[model samples]
Target chain A: MKKKLNLRKATPWLSAIGLFVLWELVVRIFNIPPYVLPTPSESIIVGWQFHEAIWMHAYHTLYTTLAGFAIAVVFGVVLGALVGSSRAIYDAANPLLVGFNSVPKVALVPVLVMWFGIGTVPAIITAFLISFFPIVVNVATGLATLEPELRDVLRSLGATRRDILIKVGFPRAMPYFFASLKVAITLAFVGSVISETVASNVGVGYLMLSASSKFNMPLVFAGLLVIAVMGIAMYEIFNVIERRSTKWANRGNPTN
Target chain B: MSNSFVELNDVKLRYSEGDDLALETTNMKIDKGEFIAVVGPSGCGKSSLLKLVSGLMPPSEGSVIVDGKEVAGPLKIVGMAFQNPTLLPWRTTLDNVLLPMEIVKPHRHRLRKYRAEYEERARKLLATVGLEGHEDKYPWELSGGMQQRASLCRSLIHEPELLMLDEPFGALDAFTREELWDILQNLWMIKPFTVILVTHDLREAAYLADTIYVMSKRPGKILVERENTLVRPRDQETTFTQPFTDLVHELRSHIRDVRES
Candidate 1:
């Protein structure tokens, strides 16, 4: 088990380094202009050189993404529960959810900017719109697909509605919730970046736009790197928290 | 002592407001401390009978009287185990066993005040089922047989007046199923609760039940009721003996007859 885990841990880093090495080799071999795609080392150096200013921009994007993600989570979970527990609500709202989900959230950026006037609000709204659907869809599906036999077992045990929700429904929903969170976190980052690109002047998306306008490709690459790092870091944090809380679920599965 | 601990009088059940009867005109009466096994072909409503007796479901057209009162809703005095262990995966084995206490009233009202006592009761129930050292383990951590044992422990933890088994050991391997039958026998021997076991296994019914009820398919109704005639503390050894196999075969033939009819 220990050896397997060690190998599992090593594989990702090995793949990442290999990819980086390939990128650098390809760039040097082709004599590609730095403006087009900076060399791996050049991007890393740029990332370091602009660390302070980049942190500020990244922080702005992070806050908007996080705030939007939080709001969406709250709305999605409550609405999901409402819809999930009722077939009528589910039927009524599911099509709307799909419709909204398919309406590329990026297209809403200009509309949001028009409504919210080029501030953090538009970025946050964009993130909320982009990231909300998965949480809703995942949670609603999870709640709907609850094992009937399990429900009967608890009901027979004299568990009230509240008890069933707290004990069975909620915990059962966690895996799905976390699954949605994984999708949501990445989408949250995308939403923030998209919004900043279109509207905001103070985020990693803005930094990328500013760098592109000036043709500072290294700075743009650095911004992209920071976004990637942030997305990965958020996902890891969520995975760790899920692991700690649901240690029971991790028992039999080696991969968990 | 009560003459009939449980009585189901002309019970009828349907899934919805206008649906045809799922179970029809079923009548049953069980004595105190009686271990009754209900066997039937699939969809025979053997489980539905247990549900009615346990007050998990109200008979649509009959009075389900337990301890002489019409069963209105889920009865607190009943414990149940299913084909699947259904142990909440998040809870430790011990905690899963104590779940009823935390949710069911009388115990729920006092659980926070007497938590240690409840924990001890849970531990004792687990130990009785040969799961002493595994109290802290999660459901997924345990093997199939072990999880089923824990599930049984959970059912019995609240010390209900009635114990309901709905094909509880059906999912287990034959050896493990036999082992559980004995474990269950010993537990009932120690403190006999009015047991209503639902199973597809005729052998299990013959072995565990003092009285075995057989039912027919779909809109299920009682086909036969046979008294075991076998003696108490019947162990695994008895299962292979001529007398027991004869009883099991008799029940099997009855089931076959019901299905054919």
Candidate 2:
């Protein structure tokens, strides 16, 4: 079992390395210009040379994304509870929220920039706007779909609505909340990057945009790599938290 | 006037205005500490009766009087268990059992002050249902039968005057169901409480109840009330007896008649 597990874990890295080698061979054989599509080795060299700059930019993206994600968590939970608790609030707000969610978040960046000015503020706002919807939807679904039998049990015990929500609904939503966090974290990064590319002077997104305009293809690829790594790291952190917090939800599933 | 512990006077329940009645003009008078079982076909509102008595829902037209007072809302004196164990998956067996105590009061207010005492009671209840060592185990770790047993402990934890069970053993296997029957009976024997059990199983009704009320198909009304004459301290041996079989047969026929009509 241990050997199999180790082999399973190694598979992805092996495929990734193989893909990079193939890309390098294709670039070298085609005699591709470094400005058009840099070889994997060239990209690595460029990334190493610009490590300090990349780290600084990555830090800005990370903090802005986190700031937005933190706001999303608080606002999502509150709005989710409100929507889930009452049919009136759900009916009233649902269509408006749907319409808002339908609008391309990229279009909203210019408007956000106009209102908040440039730099991290618009990026953070964009991140908060884009990532919060999934959390709200998942949390609301969790509370709304609470087992009727369980509700009846609590109701028969003379538990008030507040009592029921606090005791059962909130805990029931924890799994959904955690699940959404993993998805939302990725989206938060997308939001921050989009805003950064359009309006920001710093961050990995800005680094990529500036590099590409100057035909620094290798540096642009390096920026992409940094964003992907940060996104993966955040997602993994939430996944770990989710597993610990909602272990019971995953009990019957063999994958856990 | 008979001092009935729970009285349903011309009780009728309809989901909405002009909707078909779920229960129609049902009248029942349960004596204090009596174990009553209600059996009927699917969608016959056997559950509605339990809900009315437990004050989860008020009768549309008529009154549900428990302990000589009309029930206007959910009663704190009642504890309930359903077909699904409905134990919170996140909670341990002990914590699930203590859930009611944390909600219903004067116990709720006293929970913090008498935390140890409440926990002790919860532990004892778990032990009664053979869940002593499993107190700290989450619900999903336990089997279906074990979860149901813990559910029973939860219902009784608050020491409510009334217990409402809606097909509480319907999902368990035959052996597990029979085991729960004995456990439930022993609990009632030790501390008598008014029990209103709604089930489809005729044998279960005969084995556990003092009186079995058979209800008609949808828009349910009581079609028959058969008093169980089996000797006291009923057990697995009693279930095998001729009298027990006869009682079950009689209840089955009444259900059949209700179904046909």
Candidate 3:
């Protein structure tokens, strides 16, 4: 079992290294130009050379993504609880939320830029808009699907509605809420990048756009790599929190 | 009737308008501290009787009186357990047992002030159910029998006057079920709360209940009420005796009649 766990831990890194080697070989064999398709090594070199600039842009992107995600968390929890509390609120708001969610957030970046005018605000709003829906949907589902038997137990105890909500509903919704955060954090990055590419003057998205315009393809690739790493890191953080806080939910499924 | 602790008078329950009645013209009178069990076929509304008596659901017609007062809504004086232990997955066994005191007042009002006292009561109840060392464990970590034992602790912790059990031991193995009967019997002997147990098991009904009620198929109504004459402090050895077997057989005949009809 220990050997298997060690192997599992090593597999992802080994596969990533092998992929980079293959990419390097393929580029070298094809004699691809740096401007068109830089080798993995070339991209790494360029990434290292531009580390200072990349770090600044990465920081801006991170802040905007986190700010938007934080807002999404607050709004999603409150709205999800309200909608989940009754069938009437769910019925009244569900269609509007679905319609709003269906509209691609990419299209809204321009309108946001027009209003907020090419800064962190548009990127933040874009991230908020894209990520909040999943949190709301998951949290609402968690609250809504509370077992009828459990509800009956509380109700028969002369527990008030507020008592049931606080004691059972909210705690039950937590696992779902954490699950949504993992999904939403990735989407939050997507939203921020989209706005950065279209409207913002700073961020990894803007850096990539600017680098690609100058035919610095290796730098652009490095920006993409940075964004991917950041996304994975945030996702891992939430995953750890989810596992720790809601271990009981996963007791039956120990393999997770 | 005036002396009855829980009185159901011509109770009729329809879940919704234009729907068939779940229970029709059901009348029952249970004395205080009586261990009453309702047994019937599936979907026979045996559970509906327990619900009405607990005031979890109001009767569509007529009234339910408990302790000389009409039941308007859910009563604080009742403790309930179902076939599924239904302990919250998040809470430890001790905390799950203490859940009633966290909600049902005057305990709810005093919970913060008397946390240690309540925790001690919870621990004692868990000890009674053979769950002393398992108090800190989560519900999922425990076996079904252990979880059900903890659930029983949860139900009785608040010390409610009325205990409502709906097939509480139906999901357990025979040995576990029999063991729980002894545990329940001891608890009842010690505290003497009024109990309304609904089950399909005739032997269980005969073993635990003072009065065994047989319900007809839906829309259900009481068909027979048999007073158990088997001696008190009943155990597995007593179950082998002729009188206990006779009581079970007699209840079985009533159920067979109801099923055939």
* Candidate with best DockQ: 2
Where in model 2 is the C-alpha error above 4 Å? Answer: A252-256
DockQ, every prediction: 0.56, 0.77, 0.72
TM-score list, all predictions: 0.91, 0.96, 0.96
What lDDT tens digits, residue by residue, belong to model 3 across residues A1-256?
Answer: 9999888889989999999999999899989888988888888899999999999999999999999999999999999998888899999999999999999999999899889899799999999999999999999999999887678788888998899999999999999999999999999999999999998789999999999999999999999999999999999999999999998888877457
Task: Name the weakest run of 10 consecutive residues (lDDT summed) in model 3 chain B.
Answer: B47-56
Candidate 1 local lDDT, A1-256, one digit each (tens)? 7898899999999999999999999999999999988898999898899999999999999999999999989998998787777789999998998898889988999998888899799999888989988888888887888777777767877887778877878788887888788889899999989999989889999999999999999999999989999999999998888787767666766677
* Higher-lDDT candidate of 1 and 3: 3
Candidate 2, what DockQ?
A: 0.77
Docking band of candidate 1:
medium
Worst 10 residues of 2 chain B by lDDT: B252-261
Model 2: residue A215 alpha-carbon error in angstroms: 1.4
lDDT of 2 at B106: 86
Residue pairs in clash, model 1: none
lDDT of 2 by residue, A1-256 (tens): 9998888889989998999999999999999898989987888899999999999999999999999999999999999999988889999989999999999898999998889899999999999999999999999999999898888888877899999999999999999999999999999999999999999999999999999999999999989888988998999999999999898899877566
Q: Tell me the tens digit of each residue's lDDT in model 2 across B1-261.
A: 669999999889998899998898989999999999999998999888888888878789989899988999888888899999989988998899999988997899999999999999899888888888999999988999999999999889988899999999999999999989999999999989999999999999999999999999988989898899788789999988999998888888888888777
Q: Is candidate 1 or candidate 3 better by TM-score?
A: 3
Docking class of 3: medium
> What value does DockQ give for candidate 3?
0.72
